[model samples]
Target: MGLSKRNRWRTLVTASVVFSLVVMATGIALANITLWMHANPTFVSGTEKLISNFEKENPQIKVELVVFPYPDLAKKVLTGILTGDVPDVYQGWGMWFIPYIRTGKVSPVPSWVTTAEELEEKFQPSSLGAYYYKGKYYGISAETNFWRGGLHVNLDILEQAGLTIPETWAEIISSGKKLTKRDSDGYIIRAGLTWINQDNSNSQFLAGIMQNGGNYWDEQGYVKLNTPEAVKSLSFYRDLVLKHEITSLTIDMSAEVHEVYFKRLAAMLIRPGWVVSIIKAQYPDLRSAFVALPSIGPEPPYYPAETGWGYQVPAAASHKEEAWKFVKFATLDKGASRAWLTEAFLLPALKSLEDDPELLEAEKLVKVAFSQLKYGRYVGDMGSRERFTQIIFNISQEVFTQKTVVKDAVAKMEKEINEMLKEYR
Candidate 1:
């Protein structure tokens, strides 16, 4: 009977151990969270390190990163929402989030993740633009993205041309004339200023208008692109090709403008802070400096800007609490936030980190970009920013080709964009 009692006790102990193992396995299984982001080389490496650290801290949790190509990410998330198969967490663009918010696919960040007051206190009000919608906050601000403000100067080229950095619109034009190099056949061997690339032209154009005291959006919050300011903006860019003869549309139309700048075919390219990483990583020998764009108008320059990228939880998220833990860790935690900004070459969205000595020392260009934040103009009310951008590009092409006049080009842009806005409105 004693032997029998001993065997029974052993069996009970074994069962208890098995049950504990099962419970632990279940906890881990439920803790798995998926994060989605665009596949940007700059953002990926840092994200991997953060994920590893996050998993270590929360042993019960695991994170799987889902990367889509940069251009395809917006569509992928929108489709995922329709299918109710979105990731637990994802990186969101400021203007792109409007559709997700309208669809109710993204959740308002719960108080547990971050209180509204805490968010306001920790982040610069402008940096939080992307995550806020009509009366609701959706995510944590991760980066401050200034789309087209920094004028990246090739120092070697400028010094060779015997000119300093351009400080005003007139100076830029004059410098362009002096710096442009043409071959025997009158083909431009090197460009003075390269600004009309597909990726950035719209923002630059809009900045031109805003700088000239034009409003892209009317008082009623609809797109208003056909103003005199817009016409002047387009005319100036066109003259850069036809009148000034500094840069050619053919070269810019065929290749990436950044590549043109990198190859030394273009002396200056309008870029954002992130290019500091690309330059340091790819072209270490290239002598470069980033400065605020030369004043574009009689008034102070206006920069068309937006929230760069941030983290958000989907309303359809399965592991919300776990997801928020990762979000809070990645964004609000000082070490992780600093690591991300440093690795990704992004500007700080947090006020505290804006002047952090270590960060400033690491990324000196960030200070120049940060100083221009006062002139940042956000068009948060656009019905469809993607469509708006496409229209601007189309108008640019038409105006440059002389297929349409500047006034006609902007008018066409205005009409097409307003039509697209109807659906969102």
Candidate 2:
């Protein structure tokens, strides 16, 4: 009798615990519970607001966003792949995720959602190429970028000098010489234009290379940094800084170039369309106008396409079916796509919204960006993009700093690229 009584008590306690767990889960899901997710460093001030709006629309799914820094995203993602803890979805640089793709680690997207033919028509060829590899598609382009680096001219400075927007680089160079001013102690108080550091974080100098009809990669897939065309491109800018008063190197002397435009220290400088927010925020005093990147030579048509990042899904995604819904909503939603482009300050890489009113208005500044997609070349990036960029960055610096001959830079670049390609190819 004593043993039977103890068994009943144990059974009663177990049933009570199981009942509580079920009720708790039901309440959490039915009432409100966040779906844990992660995102890249792509959004600006209104990221939370956007998520809140998304939640209001889809009350069943609450997104808890963890935005990673751009520089560190690669390492974090690599770890997640190893540990099998990646979030639902995340954004990545367009070309940088090439290596992760080779392991069959990304979710295999079904053809019905975004058929291959439809994808081709939706995005520009170059944007489509960014996500395609070996008959498989790992991701889709979320934004478009190009290489029309232009001068963001401070209107206040132009007005002060009684000047007008310049049409060509020659005019800008001459005007720069006139606009530059120095203190008696020989420190430049301001420059007509500033040469912001052109290494990795920004590919500003590629505009010159493109204008001259020279490319970073040669026909045989070798680095071509020291080519005659490349030398001329670098020489043009070096001369401006080292010899002429047309421009100044930004690392040491300039204020945040974005902020300087408003402060009037720089009449014009080479930068992307995306910096407008920072410029508007930090220097509200400045009025500005943009002109196409100054032409380099008379004959060759060279406008490098803007290089934008992309969003990708991991092969190890635990809930790929659910994850793709988020990708579709975030990257392809007609309403969301337009809003994201406006909020994130980028060009739409999707096709459905070409006539989208909101995207049409905000992205008007980058109307010339798509033309770059035609002549744009991304080396080794369809699979090994990071290596491709690193090699170019190193070679570019070598040429700019006068450390290595173009021939030597090209040779070194070939070795680096081939090594990186060996894994993906």
Candidate 3:
């Protein structure tokens, strides 16, 4: 009897193990498909809602979102790509995608994208034009921003100086001189105008170049940094300190330039449109106005430097089709795009949503941002963009700090940029 009972116990244990294995296999086969996505954390809540809605509608597809701080997301994604553990979809900038594209790590937008002309018609020219690389589309614009180079003026300060908003570079210099203040020892007590002394100095320099009817690159993709137009642009920027004395390196190297403006130590600043929101939020009582950067030359077409971010799918994505579906749903769907606009205050990339009543009702600064979209020109979308910008920034700093002559500075920049472009050739 004892032997029989032991035999029965062994039989029961073996049967239970077999049943568990069968159940596990079935569960694996029936599991929901998960799509991994990464993006900046700014609008995670809205994105979560969109994901939830998508899952409810599709029922079989699940989306897993990983949010990272904007500054760190690129590095995180690049590491993931190396480890072959990348998300199915991720956020990227126009220039940031170039390295990935060169490695064949990024897939072009699905064949459904059809002709390039259709894409231009479907999205805003500047926003959609950004993602076109080497005759193919690799991504879609998630948000369009056109506030590259604008003059942010403290209206009260200008009024106190008995000046009106200036429309030309000469007028700005004239006004800036009067608005500038000095101490008894000839020290700069207040700056009349300032530029943010950060990476954005590249955009400011580019705006000057573009307004002077020059571009960073020619049709053959050569660096034009030392051209006559570029020299004029860089010289004008240098003279704002060394010649006109309207601004000083002491002010630029001090606290953040916007902070200087907020403290009423500066009468005007040349920066992007987003500064309007910052000023409004931080100093509501301070009167301010926004205008296009004054023309550096007499020209019919003065372009504003344009920059934006977008979404792309990895070529190695395990769920390319499903990822494309999500990308379409998130960026092309009216509700999803509307959520981005209403919640995150991003400018709409879709042409259809440009005139939406809801967007029109956004902050005055946002409306002003939309108005400038027509003048937007792509900036820093080439390969090695960050390195190029750093080089330009350093050159500008040398001029600003009186360490190098403008002629010498542009020549050095031209040589370095040409060497940098050789890899592309």
Candidate 4:
């Protein structure tokens, strides 16, 4: 009886092992059937075309696209990434990539698949830096943007006032006094320029400081918010508001804030390329134009601290090879430039695209912004530089609000920075 029971037990154990393998394989198959993606909720100009084109070629891959408003997307994407329920591929900030690098979840771009030399031969050196880590590539390169935020001057209004776009900070201050208009009722009948704030729609402060030869952080990456130079830049901006372009104590935070730009009531604004859309929409009858921002206490040959907004891949993607295949088909090789030049307005990061007669021959106006990508900046890959951006914002708020003067702001910023640096150091 004992010998017969042993044989029966062995048979049952063998059956259990076979059942487990079947279950595991079945689970993987179910997971592969589902692919997910998300974008900022409302489909805007460039993003809409990208999604449509990516889907057209990748029809076999079922992508479940989710859209959240900008605020909701930021919160949800952050939470979702940490919890490990991340999408196979997603759109995320290029600056915040360092944290994701630590989790060992991100897939490195395979060296054998595409050599670095080959990539460099094709694309601009800077855009590739966004997706690179410690000299090795991580995320797939999508597109590039410029950091040329400047006071998009309303030349129409300036001309009406018999003034020209000011070349220097002193000119800006003087021109504002001449151009500013008001009524006896204390309402701005027609303002010389608009005072910019630290609002969501605009983060022109960083670029403004840069334009004035002021550096955001030292080489070691400590916040030097109170540098004599940065302070001078901010002081000029402050004066522009308090002395001229003075509006109500409360800012007009509406879709129409941009409408103010087109009506030519406001003379100058530190805005981006997309501001032209507002001009076309609201002030169709008026002519709008853009120019380089004024320079001051900052360095010469001005550069706006550029922040790249592009596409990235999550480490959680099970089929990285296939995912990369899709990315390459959409964002790399001839595919990347061809899609952008033909369907979307994005200047291709690849150098080869510059030679593309289609891109070269396309419209004339697009070329101006497209060529500017060559001078754009890329945030460093070192430590959590993004966490450092908050340090900047905090010190900036204090300085702007007059809670702390320039010198104190820099010292306070350095102290706070060293505290944060201890972990990395």
Best by lDDT: 1
Local error of candidate 3 at residue 14 (angstroms): 35
Q: How far does residue 343 in candidate 1 sit from its true spot (Å)?
A: 1.6
Q: Which is the winner by TM-score between candidate 3 and candidate 4?
A: 3
Question: Which ten residues in a row are the worst by lDDT in model 1?
Answer: 22-31
Q: Per-model C-alpha lDDT, please?
A: 0.80, 0.61, 0.72, 0.55
Candidate 3 per-residue lDDT, tens place, 42-136, comes to 35655687777776555446677777766687777777666777888876665667676666778788866435676677677767655677899
Winner by TM-score between candidate 4 and candidate 1: 1
Per-prediction backbone clash count = 0, 12, 0, 7
User: How far does residue 62 in candidate 4 sit from its true spot (Å)?
Assistant: 4.1
lDDT of 2: 0.61
Model 4 lDDT per residue over 1-425, tens place: 35588788998898877765665544322223123333422224344555556555554444445565554654565566677777666655455555665556666766655667777776666566656666776665555545445456767677888888787767776776777677797666555656444331113445556656666666775455556665565555555555444432223333244556665566665554546544544456666565555444445434442334445556666666556655566566575446544433445666777657776555232454554555555544435564565665567566556687666765676677667766765
- Candidate 1 residue lDDT tens string, 1-425: 35588899999999988866775656454468999998878788879888988876676788999888988999888888878988999987877877788887888988988888888898867677767777779888787767875788899989988889887768878888888888999888888888776557787788888878888888766778778898888887889888988877766766778778888888888778788788888899999988878556776777676776888788899998999999999888887888888876787778888778888777776568767766776656567777778878887888788798888888898889889888888
Of 3 and 4, the candidate ranking higher by lDDT: 3
- Per-candidate RMSD vs. true structure? 4.2, 7.0, 7.8, 8.5
Distance from true position, residue 128, model 1, in Å? 2.8
Instruction: Point to the candidate with the largest TM-score.
Output: 1
TM-score for candidate 1:
0.89
Q: List TM-scores for all candidates, in order.
A: 0.89, 0.78, 0.79, 0.72
Candidate 2 lDDT over residue span 40-135, tens digit each: 233644456556656555554555567666667777876776677786666666665555666567775566557777777777555655567688
